[model samples]
Target: MANGTTYKTCTCRDEKGKRLGANCPKLRRPSRGGDRWSSTHGKWAYQLELPPHADGTRRNPLRRTGFDTQEEAEAELDHARGLLALDEDAHVKRRITDLILAVLKNTKKLPDTEEVRRKARTHQDLNRQITVAEWLEEFLARKRRIEATTRNGYAAHVRIYLTPYLGDIRLDRLRVSDVAGMFDAIEEFNDVIAIERASGDPERIKKVRYRRPVGASSMHRIRATLRHALNIAIKQDRLRDFNPAAVVELPAVTRPKPVIWTDERVTRWRADYNARTDLARRARARVDVIGCYISTPRPSPVMVWTPAQTSTFLTRAERHRLHLLYRLITLRGLRRGEAVGLRWQDVNFAGNTIGVHWQITQLGWQPVQGKPKTDASDRVIAVDAETMRLLKKHRANQAKERLAAGDAWADSGFAFTDELGRPLHPQIATDQFYWIAFEAGLPPVRLHDLRHGAASLMLAAGVEMKIVQETLGHVSSTFTRDTYTSVYPEVAAAAAESTAALLATPSPSVLSHGRRKPSSARRFRH
Candidate 1:
């Protein structure tokens, strides 16, 4: 019999020939011998029934949740019946069964096998563990093979800039926002330093600080370095997304033109230098007379008397180095690297030319023999008579120094060398050049300014643009013209004058007509 109360009466007659109505509760049970049930319409109805096992144990039917009315329950039953009929063999049902089996099998702990080890190895190969520090080291190692200067720059970025802030951060986990924050911190630090320097009282230096510190150019360089590092990370698969640097805005930097001495100013400074040179020589003679003081100790006497001459000698040595550098840069228009890298073999004394084939770098004053800055920079530069004479004298002095040092001298085969014949560090030469200029009462200018000075002088002297371009070893005349064109006020004035002259002359037709007008008028009167 049905366990729950029957909501409706069945009017159909069963095998007992009794009317199935509301009062006949026994008729509510499912029929014992048939696969159907009787509905209110007196028709055979299909019902959801549990199947009996082979052992005669009946399976429990799915229980239904209570509904407000019998009709609602019947409607839910009907919908469920339709669904079962349509999806009896659905793939989802099979998948659920397979999932259950998998879960049951996986209940036991699996053994570590060779296959698992191989899979782990493959995963490691694809997604290797690499820290920012490790990647930076590898990047620097690779960069070292390219250029020494570039390698040093990369090392500086890693050591001074990157490692301090972001070294501990994992490369794979690095975010764009993290890099941006680091840049902010760097700028803050720079500002604090600037503020401390601005404060006059060095004793209370720590208290003073900049409200908005750091210049735009420094921030820009920091951004650029970060951008490059991130790019490398992306290439190495340490990063999965686009570089954060691409989205971040760097500070705007406006580089001002270098301050150089004008021709008149340079001339005055040179005149002052020559006058000092004479005065220093005369002062040395006076110091010799003061050496006769017997009461003074021998070492102390010479030191006290010759101090001025010693200072002057040191000054002169620095001046000579500066003059050599200036001639190489401004007169010959050689790059700092090329000029410093020059060797005797690279110079053709007979041909009066110098071959640019190598570069000098710091870090042990090593020479990297290679092509010039560009293909055009590799050309031979013809030396003038005065330049040749100066070079010959310089070579003689170098030879004498080499002989004096003998076995102690390092045969670096460089044109510009120290007393021991070892190649001079470019930085040392640059530093000394500036010191010389400062001592000589000249404005401080960078080594590269000499190159600009050369180009400017050439432009001002009415040298052809193409010839100047070739002499400077520029890739094209356009580059030469663009860089030095502004320095050529004389060229511009000459051009203006030529244009004016052309405009001042009468036209040939007008001139001819004017000359013949008197003759024509006289003939007409006749």
Candidate 2:
């Protein structure tokens, strides 16, 4: 290692405006007090040439300026020499060589010692030039403990939306604007999908085949994916400093409010629905336009029916093949998957309680058996006397059907199944429910909303909130109260009427025309 040279100088120009070295006359002698403050010396600076690598390659010189004294410059020079001296160690020398190679190949400037050490330890590429597609693939590969459904969802977003747009961009160089622009592009493409779906030409519609519009929910999911992926990249030290995904704007999510189908609304809707569906049948019959956009069912959110309407529906559905299935949902508040996943082992007719354990969830269109949505959801609920009666009848019917089928039974052991005794498709319950509601001239209440209506009915029947929460297997009573407190208008109206009765004026007849009601402060005589 070299001591490195320290020199002092002042700005001096010749007649040609060039600096003269120690040749300046002011440095000819020291000052009167032996002080070396000659006009020639203003400040001290260092100049050092680093040793060559073990590979015998030339290295650059390290230079520093603007030191007030020689000691200041010498101290810094010692630091430089110390840093370079570490290169003598075999491992450190190899890392230094790698840094030099990276600098040469990528035209990257030399970084500090600490930075070189980080690069060596992390083993990340010297230049962060990996594309988003490559990084996302790596991200997906490293995921091990997450559920299969979650991993599949991430993969779907990457394949369908992210790759085509952001994949080519370098992960390290991705910007907030780039993320924002991707969302904008998705929204614009959503418009295109809507337009294509509306178009009558089959060829034009084919352009968007197999594609669905990027709704607010999907956009929110995409943003979440990017945010998580980028966060992981930063956390693993694969990328540095910037997090463009964190800053991108997302649309606020608004959950749809539940609506109850009261008698008046049901009557009107039944009439309109029967007429419209009948007309659709006639029109599709004439033109054979069954699958065209004109006949597409409007997107319907969760819908529930009044208690009386619910009873009417149950009466009409009782003779159907799946009467007990609808009754359990509308009366007991079972989620669609839970109803489909019911097994004989989980049922306890003697105890009059039904145990909800396994649920059949969909990964795409394929059903997968999984635990209930939450630990609380795996519950045992008591059945009412009427419900128990209905269950007994349903069990007898199932037994008869089983006997008739003989060896043809699927023996899947599911409490509910199709006519052939095979496990029923979970969605078929919803479709058949819609058919029954329409054919029976009832309001279009979705199957899941039957669960909501069940909760409402329980509350209206003076069931305690905690008991209702437990019956529904809600994790907390507050959620049960908040979500359904207003759903049963009758309960709230009763509460209002009860409160008003307490404050009602006692007998206006006793007021005596112009009197202040004989002063409510006077003691009453019995």
Error of 1 at 512 (Å): 4.2
Specify the highest-TM-score model's number. 2
Model 1 misplaced stretches (Cα beyond 4 Å): 1-220, 223-322, 362-367, 506-526
Give candidate 1's error at residue 439 in angstroms. 1.0
Per-residue CA lDDT of model 2 for 130-242, tens digit only, reads 78999999989988899999999999988877777689888866755456546645653564466566655688688678889878788888878878898899887666644
What C-alpha lDDT, on a 0 to 100 scale, does residue 149 get in candidate 2?
93
- Displacement of residue 364 (Cα, Å) in model 1 is 11
Model 2 residue 16 distance off true place after TM-score fit, in angstroms: 99
Q: Which ranges of candidate 2 are over 4 A from the true structure?
A: 1-216, 219-253, 267-283, 286-300, 501-526
